[model samples]
Target: MDHTAADDISHQANAWFALFHGGAPTPEQRAAWSAWMAADVRHAQAYAELENLWAASALLLQPSPAAAPVAPARLSRRRFVGLGLAASAAAVTAGAGTLWLNGVDSPFADLRTAVGERRIAYLPDGSTVEMAGHTAMNLDFSATRRAVELLHGQAFFRVRPSAAGEFSINTQAGRLHTREGEFCVSCENDAGLVAVSQGRVQVLTAGQQTELEEGLSLSFSARATGDIQRAELAQMLAWRNGRLVFFNEPLLTVVDALQRWRKGRIFIMDKQLAARRVSLILNLDHPDQMLDVLSRALAVRTTRYTDLVTLIYPA
Candidate 1:
């Protein structure tokens, strides 16, 4: 109602939220909280407001290693960033407080396609997002944060960085900061891949960060650390140009690329066949045709089921 009342409510709400993160409260503290809950309707309202703040602030709340209360002076920078997000969330919740206290709609919220679907999206910030096959993501941009939540499948991002802002790809593992790069992110629930084709990018997980430059790749798994490996530039990036270039590349890797382009699967009967290096350019448009060309070029026999699946074996 009044400024003092609002400030008090905000302070109490923040305190309670801090307790929630600090760990389970003592029975005495719990009794106090319960008594406070019944003290007045405004107390309940303020507590609910604080819970909204916590949800809006989830992005900032990294788990403390010791599970202890984080002092105000020791609050991480991420918490400060979360403060801005919390304000934004506050704005959205002012009217429809009943609704989840979240930021505006995701950029990829409306992005989808049918089976064997593909669409290209040009973001407002001049970056281009190519949704490969059946992919989805939500795009959210504000003064402080530029982010996209990859819902499923794969998407290649040529991010146009803002001079004064940070662009991040938020997945289950954590946030990836793309400073300047042409990168591809393939996300399937808990496991994901972040490959940088050019420039540089940073992957943030838990409290750790990894910087990946051009020709570098990293795979992230939920509840575990990630592995950083050298990336083959041509094969990792060829999809952008509608071709997959394999210069003495392994057959297995080539088959994996074909799988992404089409719906079916490619099975190699001989494991030694995977060691054989084959140099060829496969057009993504017609995977079956590529198989036929491979068959001719490598003396391999390919058996086909539907247009979506194929198997390659030595002739």
Candidate 2:
């Protein structure tokens, strides 16, 4: 295809999109539009591509005040990013994902959430587990045992009574052994951040064992407790109510929280932008608005490819 001709088609596609966004057209205009779309195969393809782009930018288009927000339209496109071993090692991926197009189904996953979705699962032992977006967990039970494996992402566990004995949890990072308590664990970078909401849980990483009491949080990295801190347990688990609470955290960390509920992958290409400090409260249900606010506050802009991927770069 000629480069100039392809550009012309794209330009025409954008024009048609503007007309559609402007509102319903007259009969004559609709007929002309139909004729233009049917004029050539390339014309239809070009229009479809532009429609996908518009879908990806759904946040930018707001309807009347009383109308509900529009959902993102799914469309396929060519994958752009190619990360080799070296690049993958250097690029630290960050971002929240949500609004699952397709929920997960696995024999091992007794409880799971699709991308951009969160769910609560009630275990047989009267315990409850709240799963974050893109999270999966498997429950293990026996005459003398109860355990849960955090296969991926994060979850908040409310264990059965201590009279029933200890409940063990396994993640990519380490094991959290607890009883009669509520707590949350998040896995990232081959590590786990355990925040205790009530009662104490013994954390066993490698050969070390320590008790994590209420109001205390610890980060275990690569089978070891590296950094520990105290926090407001209630604030940490605010996502149960569909909100993200952050305080003096790096922009990269914020991105991780946002990825929990937003659909598609969001890439932050600038290291400096990722490292900047941030403090804010974000509503998980309105992820598009969240991204718009972040981009403006961080002096950045997003380049989206349909609804498949979103890339963030300095403006």
Which predicted model would earn the best TM-score?
2
Off by over 4 Å in 1: 1-109, 112-119, 142-144, 172-174, 188-191, 223-231, 274-277
Off by over 4 Å in 2: 1-108, 162-164
Please, what is the whole-model Cα lDDT of each candidate in the order they appear? 0.62, 0.70
Taking all chains together, the TM-score of candidate 1 against the true structure is 0.54
Clashes of each: 6, 12
- What is candidate 1's lDDT per residue for 110-180, written digit by digit as tens? 66533234578887667888876546677787666677887666778888878637778888766688766
TM-score of each: 0.54, 0.69
Please give the TM-score that candidate 2 achieves against the real structure: 0.69
Candidate 2 local accuracy as lDDT? 0.70
Highest lDDT: give the candidate number. 2
Query: Across residues 198-237, which tens digit of lDDT does each residue of candidate 2 receive?
Result: 8888888887887888867998866568655664553477
